[model samples]
Structure formats: structure tokens, C-alpha cells
Target: MARPYEPGPSTSLSTNTLSQTPSSPVPEEDDDSGAASPELPLTMSASVMLADLPRDATAALASVGGFPQEKVVVKFKPVGAAPSLAQELCKISATRKFEEVVRYLRRKLRCKDTDSVFLYVNSAFAPSLDEVVGNLHQCFKNGQDQLIVAYSMTPAFG
Candidate 1:
């Protein structure tokens, strides 16, 4: 049978770099050089595993007040040398994927299969093709209640 383990003086070694008795509960003082010690005291905090959901998914779902509107207004803007559309604004189904917007732009521009087009939301970021249009509208809609989409013939915005 194994002997019961015991914590002796040797086992309870000083974990801190400062010279202090084991019984002392005081924190070590800063150095005369006016620099704080690199070592920091350990702290315990409780955390919860929020199921099998990503942080953005949870936050997006939480911020949206209710079901997305049936349709969302998308206002397209041309960047760089890209051609402008006669009708700059159009209405699209909210539940449609972002790929629809891309396809629509391509059809309007009469682009060939080899031609590449880039789209950005609020002229800021290029979202995934599979992302929902409603979510994009909800997140980046302008004061005029329209989703501002900046289109380019090549990768433009950062």
C-alpha cells in the first residue's frame, strides 16, 4: 500500500522570489528603481462554457431586437475604376445570402466569368459570401436605413 502523502517544509517551498517567511501574508514592496516586479499574484475567476456557439454568433443574436425585416435596402457605390449602376439603390430579400448581392452586381455590370468583383459593407470590411444579408443590414445600415455596399473591380478597401 502507498504511504499517505504529507506536505513537509521541503515540499512547501517558497513560490515567491522575495525573501519572506511562509507565515507572512504581506505582499512584497516595489524596488527602489521605481519599477514594479514582473511577478504577479495568482487570481481565480469562474468562467462558463457558453455551449457550442461562437462569440460573434451569440453577440449578433443578442443585439438584434427581433426578426429581420422582410426586405432590406442595399445602396451600391462604385470605387476606383468600377462602373456605376444606373439604379444605385435596390431592395433585396433579407434572408438571402451575400452571394446574391454579388451575383446581382455581376449581372448588372455584365461581368465575364474571369472578371473579379469585390464588395465591402459600409466601405469597411468584406464579409463572407455565405453571410446573411439581413444580419449585414442590421449591423451596418446607415442613418437612411439602407445597407451601404461599396463595390470594386479589385480588392480595394482595407
Candidate 2:
């Protein structure tokens, strides 16, 4: 019969004292700190320096070395409390920045500097303004081959 593991003072038990196979290594009661315990590596901690990593992450965006030849179709979508555009669809140079789309929306809406316009792709996430439009379209375009951009006057998605 096995006794309850009383993990203190080396557990001077008559039954366990003469065991062949060693039990799991447990921390002694004297050890107050978890110094021997291993820690899990954080995903966010794994970062690369700018010098080590490429500036452009995608091949689609890296094609900017050549002249702006390809055009991506951008379809505007209105989110909660946002007004819709007169023309929902538009064609833009693939090499252009996402900032261009934001600027275009601002212009169409006649938004002042004080007015904030938030834009998201696929109504899921907001891309950086500096991100290339071609890369976004290539990665997240809808079935109709259109880059669906959802815009909102206020914060919509987390």
C-alpha cells in the first residue's frame, strides 16, 4: 500500500525509502523561491532588429522596384455610424500606400483635419498607413478580386 506523499523533511516513509524507481523531483519545503523552475519563452519577446530583417515583408509589395504597372480594385465599405461613398468602387496603383486610400476617403467625405477616419481591411484588422496596397490586396482581397476596405467614424473593431 502507498501512503500520501508528505513532501517535507525528505518524507522519511518506510515504504518509499527503499523504492527502485525515483519519484518525480519535488521542491523541498525549505526552498522558498522557485529558482529551479523553468519559464516559457514569450512569443512577443522574439523580435528581430531592422538591420537583420527585410523592410518589405511580402514579395507583392517588393515589386515596387519596377514602375507602378498593376492596379488593385478597392471597394469601400461603411461601418457603424459611417456614411457611404457615392462610388463604392475605385482602381488605384498597386504600389501606392494605404495612406492614399485614407486620404481619398477624407477627400471624398470632405473631412477636416480634426475629423478622424478609421479604415480597416476585410472589416477585420486595420493596416498601417505605410503598408503597400498591393500586398494587402494580394493577401486579403474578396472573391470578386476587390480589396474590401471598411471605414468608420469611430472605433469599431478591437
Candidate 3:
């Protein structure tokens, strides 16, 4: 059976202080001062920075690895009403629609028939705080409570 949890002797209290105070109990046994404490690791999911996604995700998913680069998923969305392409791209970034903005650029932005490519989101951005709170139960049950997606960004790697 697993050992029951105990309130460890207060490591933070100094031995001198304990000695001065007769009522205090002896210090708890410690394996080593340098040894790491038994603690839970953060439950956060890893995020995929735009540049790293293509090389990293593809290598792990062989189906993606050998496939043509053009077949890779492209996320984009248009931002603000703008006739100028640069303005539109700038608006996308400012709005934080990481996926949607990229998609729009892929289809619209061009130079000598070549496009200056990057990531974008089509949506408003990471979901609002209320939306996240609403999904908290589902997230917790699925071990995804720590997983947070920005309202505009579809979280490149979930």
C-alpha cells in the first residue's frame, strides 16, 4: 500500500530556533539537502512556436514527413478592412489571430507572384476567459485543464 501523506517536519524552521524553543519537535529526516523534492511536474502542454512546428511535428508523424511541403496545414485569417496587403498582415498580427491571419496571407499576399509567408489564425484569437472557464470541467477530466489556447491562435501544437 502507498504510504499516507504526512505533514513533513518544518524544513524551513532553523535548527537553532528549534533548539531555543523546547516545545518544538525534532527536525524531519531529509535524504539530502541537494536532492530534489518529490513534487508533481507542471501539467502544462507544450506549445509549438511557428518556426519549430513544421520540422518537429512532421518528423514524428511520418505521414507528414514525406508529404509535400505544400500539403502542410496552413492557418490564416484576414484582419481589418484594408486595401493594402501589408496593412492587412500587420492587422492580423496585432489582433493575435495566429492561425486565421496566416491563412489569409497565404491566399492574398503576393510579390512578383511569390508570397511572403508566415503563420496566421482565421478566428478572433485565443478564446475568452469565460469560454475557458466554461470548458474547465471537460478539460480537467481529460487532463487538459492546463491546456490553454489563445483566443485567436489555434495553439499550433495541442
Candidate 4:
């Protein structure tokens, strides 16, 4: 029997990091010699499974009133794969979880919050709309019954 795949907790998945590099003579508070913060810079991305589907794409755009246009991306593979594919997959995943990805980018890269996150789309790889919608609907139904919060996240503060 083909065992079904299960997703672990999403906590570790949040990849928010500083968007910019710190400037100049490192702010020295007292003479602690050479001590650096543990926090490091990182990039953000995501991946979705389309095991039994067609095509591959990254993101779709949605307009939210007042808020910036929400750019939702789709990824057809899991977290790890070939180098190039993995990078693309991560990009897509990042788009889906825009807030988390942006937080990481801005925090690590020191990018401005106003900067636009170009959600990439691997349309050459994504599955068809019918399959995507159907699978999502089924997942939604199952999660609903179990009261699973599939894709909820906390708000980010500056």
C-alpha cells in the first residue's frame, strides 16, 4: 500500500529573516571583544505537491482592498529536490506565505517593507486548474472535518 504523506508542523517553515545588511562600524555596546548575534540572513520559498496532476506554476495575483495586491504563488514539488528545481520550488512557496517570506527578506536583506516581492510562476510546471481546484477542495473538506488550520499565520510587527 502506498503510504500517504503527512506534513509536519509549519512553525519551522516560517523563514522570515532580516532583509538588509547592518551598516558600518558595528554598533559596539561595551567592550565584549568579538561577539556577534546568532541571527543570520536567509531567503524564503515554498513548495506544494502535485503528484497526480499536470503543469507547474508558481503564483497567482489577487487584489485585496487597501492592502497591496496579494501575489499568491504555487509550487508543484516538495521542499527538497534538484538544485534548480529546489530553488524554484522555494520561490513559489515563499509567495504563498508572502508575509513570512517578506519578513525574512526585509529583516535579513535590510530591504524596505515597501519593496515588491516578485512572486515567480513556473507555469511550465504547475498542474491544470481542474486538478488543482479539485485536490484543494478535497483537502479543505478533510481539514475542515478535523478543524485543521492549514495555512494560518500570525501578523508581523516592525
Candidate 5:
């Protein structure tokens, strides 16, 4: 059988021993020391400044160079009993808002002022009218290199 273990004496800590140690310094409290410390100037090394920035910040700065705007092709797919248009595909400026697509659909359908139209992408979800069409196309485009948008005269896909 193994002998029972015994703890070494150095493990014990007493208040008197802790106060008498040369490395420990006791803080002095001053009730009148309410003045704020002086502010330091904001200075950072190049490597540290780059490291502290968000990952996308560098990519965004790189894209600031001159870039030409490209048009995107949007293919409209009617759902349920929605009327089909003679033209199913249209090209729109990449920077145009999604509201332009909705307006174009309404005009093509000759819908009344009170009629409601719902637009969705990939038969999945409806995007906000303020969303950029180019961004949506870039993210949700189909294999045919076109943005597939499904529309209905009434509420179809939630």
C-alpha cells in the first residue's frame, strides 16, 4: 500500500506574511483625486492599424478603383394562375432598385391601382422593394446566368 501524502509548508498563506513581502505594494486611497486623466493621441502602427480593421474593409477599399457598371438579366416566372407575359426576360441596370422590377411587372400586367402583386426569388422568399436588383442577382442567380424571379397576382409564397 502507498504511504499517505502530506502537503508542504510553503502552500499556506497568512495575512501578516503577505503584508511584509517586499514585492507587494499597498494602494493609498485619496478622496480628493477626482480629476480625470489626460487623453492620449490616437496613434497606431501600420501593421496594427490594418490588423484592427474589419476583414471586408480592405476589400471595400480595393474596390474603390474605377469599375464599369454592368446590366443584369432578370427572368420572370409566373406562379399559379398569374397571366404570362409575351416577354419573360428583361435586362435592367445593376444599380437599379428592386422596386423598378415590380413597377415593370405591374405595367406589363396592366394591373389596377388597387391590385396587389407579390415578387419572390428562387421561389423561396420575397425581397424588400428597396433591395438592389444587382446584389440579388449576384447572390441568387440560377445556372442560366439570370436572376429568376417568381411573381403572382395574389399572395402566393409566404
Candidate 6:
């Protein structure tokens, strides 16, 4: 009969035996100099994952066609030394510019070349003439759903 099989310590596999194999190349050590060694080049993959984001509501509305024109109500309040118009409340197109409001006030007051008129929104800072009246009214309308504008012959609130 053949001899019975026997387990021995030398028959077991170990990390030392695997690393000693000739398949992998060993790194060489540099000379004992004080100079820094060059680093290995990094490798990267170019694949990227992009997430879908929702579109802006305003931009979506604009693409269908520009914002619809609406009638805006303007309430005029005269400051110190400023003359009031015959009609304090008037309706204007939302697409009109603030300069149009200034011109309308000037025409109603019959202002002279030397006269100056200043307009403010909510008695606060003065907006640029090029600003759209509709945009301003939408942003700063009073509780009555009216654009409250204060006018003065001289600079009052600056």
C-alpha cells in the first residue's frame, strides 16, 4: 500500500514566497545623495457624470415670447415746494421707461428749462431713467397695488 499523505510546514504558501517570484520587477534605490527624486506621472480617466438641472422659470417664460404688457397704476405724491398734478393717479404702460414718467411729470407741471424735477420710488433711492417702470412696480408696489412715486422740485432724498 502507498504511504499515507502527510501535511508539513514547508508545503504551505506565504507572502515571502509570492513576492520572491520573478513576474514583478523590483524598484531600484537611488544613490545616498541629498537631491530630490522626480515623481511618477499620474494617470486619470476622462469619463464624467453630468446631472440634469431644472430650467429657470423666468427664462422659460421669456422664451415663449417676451413678458406680456400690462397696465400699471402710478400714484404721485409731491414733496416740499413741488407742485401737484391735476390727476395724482394715472395709468401707464408697463413697458414704458422711468424717463417717460419724468417727462410726463414735467409736461404736467409746465416746468421751464431752468426747472428741475426729481422722482423717487417709495420715497427711497432714485432709480435710473432707463429702468423699466413695470419692473420697478413689480418690485416696489405699495399695499394698494400702486407704484408710489414722490416727486420734488429739488433733491430731497438724493
Model 2: per-residue Cα lDDT over 15-127, one tens digit each: 55666544343533346774632322222334445654455565656754654338999999999989989999999898999999999999998899999999999999999
Poorest lDDT segment (10 consecutive residues) of candidate 3: 145-154
Ranking by TM-score: 5, 6, 1, 2, 3, 4
Residue 2 displacement in candidate 3 (angstroms)? 3.1
Better of 2 and 5 by lDDT: 2
Q: Per-residue CA lDDT of candidate 6, range 50-129, in tens?
A: 57435686568665534244778999999998987889998889889999999988999999979999999999979999
**Which structure among the candidates has the greatest lDDT?**
1
Could you tell me every candidate's TM-score relative to the true structure?
A: 0.59, 0.58, 0.17, 0.17, 0.61, 0.60
lDDT of each: 0.82, 0.80, 0.33, 0.28, 0.77, 0.77
Off by over 4 Å in 2: 1-69
Model 6: number of clashes? 0
Task: Give lDDT tens digits, candidate 5, residues 1-158.
Answer: 43333322323445797575433221223467654222312223212434466778878887764224488899999999899989999999888899999999999999999999899999899999999887898789889889999999888876
Higher-TM-score candidate among 1 and 2?
1
Q: Which stretches of candidate 1 lie over 4 Å from their true place?
A: 1-66
Error of 3 at 72 (Å): 2.7
- Candidate 4 residues lying further than 4 Å off, grouped into runs, are 1-96, 121-158
**What residue runs in model 3 are displaced by over 4 Å at the alpha carbon?**
4-70, 73-76, 84-120, 126-158
Q: Model 5: what TM-score?
A: 0.61
lDDT per residue for candidate 4 within 41-114, as digits (tens), equals 22222224566533333222222112222232323222222112223212222123334543433343344656
Question: What are the per-residue Cα lDDT tens digits for candidate 3 across 87-136?
Answer: 32122222233344334444554423443332322232343322322232
What is the clash count of model 5? 0
